[model samples]
Target chain A: MATYPRDLQYTREHEWARIEDDVIRVGITAYAVEQLGDVTLVDMPAPGEDVQAHERFGDIESVKTVSELFAPVSGEVVDVNTDLESSPELVNEGPYEDGWLVTIRPSDQAELDGLMDAAKYEEYLGTLDG
Target chain B: MSEALRETSLTDEHRALGARLVPFAGWRMPVQYEGIKKEHEAVRTRAGLFDVSHMGEILVEGPQAVAAVDRLVTNDVSKLTTGKALYTACCNEQGHILDDLIVYRLEDEKVLVVCNASNRDKIVGHFAQNLSLGTPWNDVSDAWALLALQGPHALATMKDLGAPPSLLELPYFSVTRASLGGVDLWAARTGYTGEDGFEFFCASEDAVALWRALIEAGTCHGLQPVGLGARDTLRLEARLMLYGNDITEETHPLEAGLGWVVKLDAGDFIGRDALRAIKGAGLGRKLVGFEMTGRGIARHGYPIVANGEPVGEVTSGSPGPTVGRNIGLGYVPLALAKVGTTLGIEIRGKVVDAMVVRTPFYKR
Candidate 1:
C-alpha cells in the first residue's frame, strides 16, 4: 500500500496539494500513478491560466490510457513542472515530491481545508477498493 | 454482478508472480507484473515468458483437414508441409476479416489452428456453420497450455531448458516435437513479436511444471514473466495486428495491409471472389503507420483530421517503447497514406500534427 503525505491535502479525483506561502503546488497522488501504471506524458495547464476548483486543468497520459487532471482549488497557474516534459516516469517514482505537476498562485487558499487529509483520504480510498 | 471469467491452468502461477489479473476475451489473465515498459524492454533486450493459454487452439484431423483449412483462410495452406506454419486471415463472404490466425501443419492429415481469444468462438462457429463435410475437428484449447518464449535470447533459453539440437535449431515459422524436463511438447519457431522466438504447446497438466522449469532455467538468460500489456505493445511496435483492434469484421483484408496473405490464384476459398473483386476496384483507404509530430498521442477511436474535417480513424496507437516515439496505425485515403504525409489527429477535440511513417517502427 502507498502512504500519503500528512502535510498535503488530497481530492477524491486523486490529486494532492502542497501549500507553500501563496503558491499551492498540485499533482496527482501516488494512487493515481499506481492505477494508470507507467506515466508517459503530462499535459499541464500553462502559467497565468485561471483554473476553477473541481474542474479539469489538464490531462495525463499513461502507456495504455489517458486521464484528466482536476484542480483542487481555484487558482492562477504560476508555474508548470517542465521536468515532466522529458521524464514523465518520475511521476510513477515520486508522485509526492519531484513529480509535482504544476504550482498555482491560489485565488483562495481556504479551499485546501475542504480537501481530505492523510487519514481521511486513506478512508476514502478504502471505500473505492471495497 | 458480471459473469465469471474462465482461467487457465497457470492462473495460480501468474498470481504468485504478482501479476495484475484482468478480464480479457472470456478469461481472467495477467495484464502486467511489474510495469509494461520494463517488461517490454526485457523482451526486446533478453527474453520474456508469456502465458498465452487464452489463445484458442483447434485440431483438425482426417483426410480433408488440409483441404478444409486451406479453403478457410486467405493464405496457401497446401504448401505447408509437416512442421510448417503460416499467418493468414479468415474472411467472411463479404470480404471482411473474421480473424487473423496462424495455421500449423503438424502432419499430413493434421493441422493446428491458433486464433485470437476474442474471435475464437466466432471463428469456431464459422467452421461448424460453413464446412459442409463431416470433418474431424476439435477445440483442444483446454487440453494444452500455450507459452510464447520471445526475444533475442529465446534460443539460449530453450537450450538452457535441456532442449535437443533439433528443437534449438528449428527454423522460422516451423514446428517440431521436443521435450524438456521430461515433458513432451511441440515447439514452434513463431511468435507475435518481431523477434526470434518459440511458442511451446504442452499438455495442460504439465503447464505448471513446464512454466516453473523454464523460469528456473531462464534466470541466467534474464527472462522475465511478461503479461498482456507488454504483449500488445511489443506486437504493436512490430506492427502485428490485434484481432478486434487492428483487423475487424468491418475492415477488408487488403485495405488493412494483408494483401500478401490473400491468395486468390491458389484455390477457391471463402471470400476469395469478393476479395478479388475488391482488389480489382482498387482500395480507397489504406491502413498506415504514423508518428506524432505535435504534442498528443493519437489513441484508438481518435479521428484523423484534414482541413478541419475527419478523414479517417485510428485503430491502434501507443508509445512505442523501443522506437522512442508515439506511433499508431490508422486508415486514411490512399492518396494521404504515403510516407511523410502530414496529418492531424483530433485528441480531446484538439487537432495535433502527425505524419505517416513506415510500419514495424522497431526492427531488430
Candidate 2:
C-alpha cells in the first residue's frame, strides 16, 4: 500500500499540501508516483509565478504518459525544486520529501481548509479502484 | 462502442508476479511489474522475459503458400529456407505500410506470419481478399503463447533450462524446435530488443508451466518478468519501428527508414509498382533520429521545428536507458533530414533544441 501521511492535506487530483505559517509546501502524493511508473522529466513552475487553486502550474512526464501538476491552493510561487532538474527520479523515490515541487505563499489561507484530510483522501483513493 | 478487452493465458501469472495491468490495443496487459527502468536495464545487462502473447500469429499452408505470401509482403519470402524468418512489411496498393511483421518459413508448404496485435484482424482480412482460392489459411493466434527472453545473458539462461547447447549455433532469425518441462516449444533466435536472445512459442495450455519453469531456471541469471513499458523503451533505444507509433497506414515503407526490407528487383508484390515509382522520384520526407540537446523528453506527436517554424512531427521519443540520452525519431523534410541538422521540438509550448543523428541509438 502507498503511504499517506496523516499530517498532510490532499487534493482530489492527488497532490499533497503541508500547511506552514504563510506558505504551503506542495508535492504529488506517493500514489501518483506509483501510477506514473518511471518519472523521466519534471517541468516545474518558476518562483514568482502566480498560480491559482486547481490550475495547472506544470507537468510531470513518465515513460507512458504526461500528468499535469495541479495547484491545490492559490498562491505566489516562493520556491521551485531545482534538484529535480538532474535527478527527476527523486519524485519516484521520495514523493513527500525531496520530491516536493514548490512552495507558495498562500493568497488566501482559507483554501487549505477546503482540501481533503489524509483519511478522506485515502477513502477517495479507495473509491477510485472500485 | 468499443470491443471488450481480451486476456492472455498468462494473465493470471502476470498478476501473481505483481504486474500493474492496463488496457492496451483491446487487451488487458501488464504495463510494468516493478519498474520500466529496472526491467529495461535487466534486459540490457542480464535477462528479461516478456509475455508477448498479445502479438498475433497466422498460419498459411499450401502448395502455393510461398507464391501468395510473396505477393503480399515486400521482402523476398522466396529466399527464406525452412526454419528461417524474414522481417518484412505488408503494404497497401499505394505502397503505404499496413503493418510490419516477421514471416517464418516453418516448411516448404507451411508459413507463419506474426503481426502486430492491433492489426491482426486487418491483416487476416487482407490475406483473405488477396490469397488464391483453396489456399489453406488459419488465424491460430490464440493457440499459442509467446515469450521473449532477451539480454546479454539470455543464451546462457536458455542452456540452463535444458535447451540444447547446439541451439546457440542457430543463426539469427532462425527457428528450432525444443522441449522443456514436457512441452514442445518453437524457439526462434530473434527478439525486438537489440540483444542475443530467443522468442519462444508454445501451446497456450502450457503457458503457466513454461513461465514458472523459465523463472525458476533463470534465477541464477537475474531473469525478470518484464512488461510492455520496458518493451517499448528497449525497442526505442534500438530504434525498432513500432507499427502504430512509428509506421502507419499513411507512412510509406521507404520514408520510415525501412528501405532495406523492400527488394524491388526480387519480384512483383502488391505495392511494387508504387514503391518502384517512389524509388525513382526520390523521397520528400525521411525519418531521422534526433537527440534532445535541451531539457525535457520529446514525446510522440510533438511538432518538429526548423528556423522557428513547424516542419514535421515526432513519432517516438523517450529517455533511452541503454543509450543514456533522450532520443527520438521524427519525419523531417529531405532538406533537413541530414545528420547534424539542428532542429527544435516543441515541448509543452516552448521549442527545445535537438540535433539529427545516426540511428540505432543504442549499439550493443
Worst 10-residue lDDT window, candidate 1 chain A? A104-113
User: Which DockQ-derived CAPRI band holds candidate 1?
Assistant: high
Interface RMSD of each: 0.7, 1.0
The docking quality of candidate 2, as DockQ, is: 0.84
Kindly report which residue stretches of model 1 are placed more than 4 angstroms away from their true locations once superposed.
none
lDDT per residue (tens digit) for residues B61-120 in model 2: 998888889889999998888899999989999999999999998888999899999998
Model 2 segments beyond 4 Å from truth? none
TM-score of chain A of 1: 0.97
Pairs that collide in candidate 2 are none
Q: TM-score of the candidate numbered 2? A: 0.98
Query: How well is each residue in A1-130 modelled by candidate 2, as lDDT tens digits?
Result: 7999999999999999998787899999989999998898899888999999999999998887899999999989999999998888999989999999999999988898899999999999999983
Give the alpha carbon lDDT tens digit for every residue of B50-113 in model 1.
9999999989999889989989999999888999999999999989999999999988889999
Individual DockQ of the candidates? 0.83, 0.84
